[model samples]
Target: MKCKDCQFCKYEGAGIAGGYKCKHPNIEESAKKYEQLKRKVINKDYPHIGYQMIKTSLRYCPYRIDREESL
Candidate 1:
């Protein structure tokens, strides 16, 4: 997938193939948080709440896959 699809990536140009930067300062922290939130969804622990939280958290995750790619 292209870097533009990554949550941590910041696109500088006008298109998807443009230059970008990984905005996550702490990769480990970002990953940990992502995983924890993901588990909540998997375990069905307040799925509604977890889904909302995960939606926001995923946008800042360093390891998040491109939504386009996943489909």
Candidate 2:
């Protein structure tokens, strides 16, 4: 299922800057890596490659909990 349909997905921030983030405890490592890659892109450390890598790294969550089931 898509992350947007998962129970662990949480929306943070506000307005246009707001987005859904995975809150699954098991996603900590992946989240950290994502943050690091995000920083690199923001800091222009690996601008081109970072963006591509980030795109590839984003996949359907393995630990996703279906919202319907949880409810």
Candidate 3:
């Protein structure tokens, strides 16, 4: 799939791979806020931050040509 189709994609340089990288937040990092929130979750034993974050990150990519244009 093209960067435009992926939520984690960002338009930085030019061309495909040259200009793109996976920018999904969770892929990039677990921020202080997220870590704190994860600690507070009742089900601390379970892995709860992987899939959802990936999905969300992919869904909101900046370089996605198919992505909805902002007004």
Query: Which digits, one per residue and each the tens of the lDDT, describe model 3 over residues 1-71?
Result: 44345555544544432434566544323333344534643332121223222334332233332234332
Candidate 2 regions with alpha-carbon error over 4 angstroms: 15-17, 30-57, 64-71
Separate clash counts for every candidate: 0, 0, 4
lDDT of 3 at 37: 39
TM-score per candidate:
0.26, 0.38, 0.25
Candidate 1: list runs displaced more than 4 Å: 1-24, 40-71
Ranking by TM-score: 2, 1, 3
Clashing residue pairs found in predicted model 2: none
Whose lDDT is greatest here? 2
Q: What is the C-alpha lDDT of each candidate?
A: 0.40, 0.42, 0.37
- Candidate 3, TM-score vs. the true structure? 0.25
Ten-residue region with minimum lDDT total, candidate 1: 44-53
Q: Which lDDT tens digits does candidate 1 get at residues 1-71?
A: 23434455454444543344456566446445656665632332111122112223333244443342366
